[model samples]
Target: MLRSTGSSALNFGEAQGANTDKDYINKASISLKEFKESRVNLKILSKVDYGNASRRVELLDELEQLIRIIATIIKNKK
Candidate 1:
């Protein structure tokens, strides 16, 4: 999950400087999906009593916020 998240983040960085709105939206979409996946994985781990539940919750909150922001950008791009 971490690897996926990191990869998505790198992609997002490239997307941030995209020359076209469509390209930015496309890349941001991928990054957002990856973030959501990470968030869900965090939830599953927490439910299974894996890593620090508190830390997972914190990360979840951050991911949710990021997802919202990215979604807004995609929406506005359209």
Candidate 2:
């Protein structure tokens, strides 16, 4: 969802300023979760039989790529 997609990025920004390793890791985990949720939303949107399919699919692709990039960041945060 929009909330998750945006929240993930927001959480990541907050994590950057985290004062402890645990805080950083926690926030990154939250971000990763949101990213996954966003992916789910986009996937569901893609399956809808009505509405703007082309535009929805394109947006889904973009969101999926964004989630993937965020996932990479989370995985590399050690």
Candidate 3:
């Protein structure tokens, strides 16, 4: 999900025009939604002892960072 959003932003950077910006913003927004959903699911899994607690914490932290980064990109594009 992070890679997809990053790729969309990178492609926008390589292109020239307003349309690219809108496209990137749209794609990144969708990716952001999915990332958020994943975060929710991760939280649920953690409650059930689906993985190492430490590792789950690490992943949740990383996912939050990615979400913020993608949100920043979308904001700046607008």
Candidate 4:
């Protein structure tokens, strides 16, 4: 899950310099999928008693905000 988030951040960083709007949107979409994976993993961790539930929930909230921001970027891309 850490690897997933790290790689997604890297992908998003690369997307920052995309040569075209379409390319940026495509890469951002991939990052969004990866973020979703992390979100699900966090839920699993909570269900299995793997971590502090409160902290995990907080992380989920942060991830949700990030997902929304990325989705909005994709939606408004021209």
Query: Lowest summed-lDDT stretch of 10 residues in model 2?
Result: 42-51
Which residue ranges in model 1 land beyond 4 Å of their true spot?
Answer: none
Candidate 2 segments whose C-alpha is farther than 4 A from its true place: none
Tens digits of per-residue lDDT for model 1 on 20-68?
Answer: 9889989989988888888888888888889887888888898889889
Question: Could you give the candidate ranking by TM-score, starting with the highest?
Answer: 4, 1, 2, 3
Candidate 4, residue 58: Cα displacement in angstroms equals 0.7
lDDT by residue for model 3 (8-75), tens: 44544443343577776776677677677778777887989896899889988987897898789789
TM-score of each: 0.91, 0.75, 0.74, 0.95
lDDT of 1: 0.86
Tell me the whole-model lDDT of each prediction, alpha carbons only: 0.86, 0.81, 0.71, 0.91
Q: Report the lDDT of model 2 for residue 72.
A: 75
Top candidate, metric TM-score: 4
Q: How well does candidate 2 match the true structure, expressed as C-alpha RMSD?
A: 1.9
Candidate 4 local lDDT, 2-30, one digit each (tens): 98898789889988989999999989999
Ranking of all predicted structures according to lDDT, beginning with the best and ending with the worst: 4, 1, 2, 3
Candidate 2 lDDT over residue span 10-70, tens digit each: 9999989999877888898898888888878777877776468887788778877876776
**RMSD of each predicted structure:** 1.0, 1.9, 4.6, 0.8
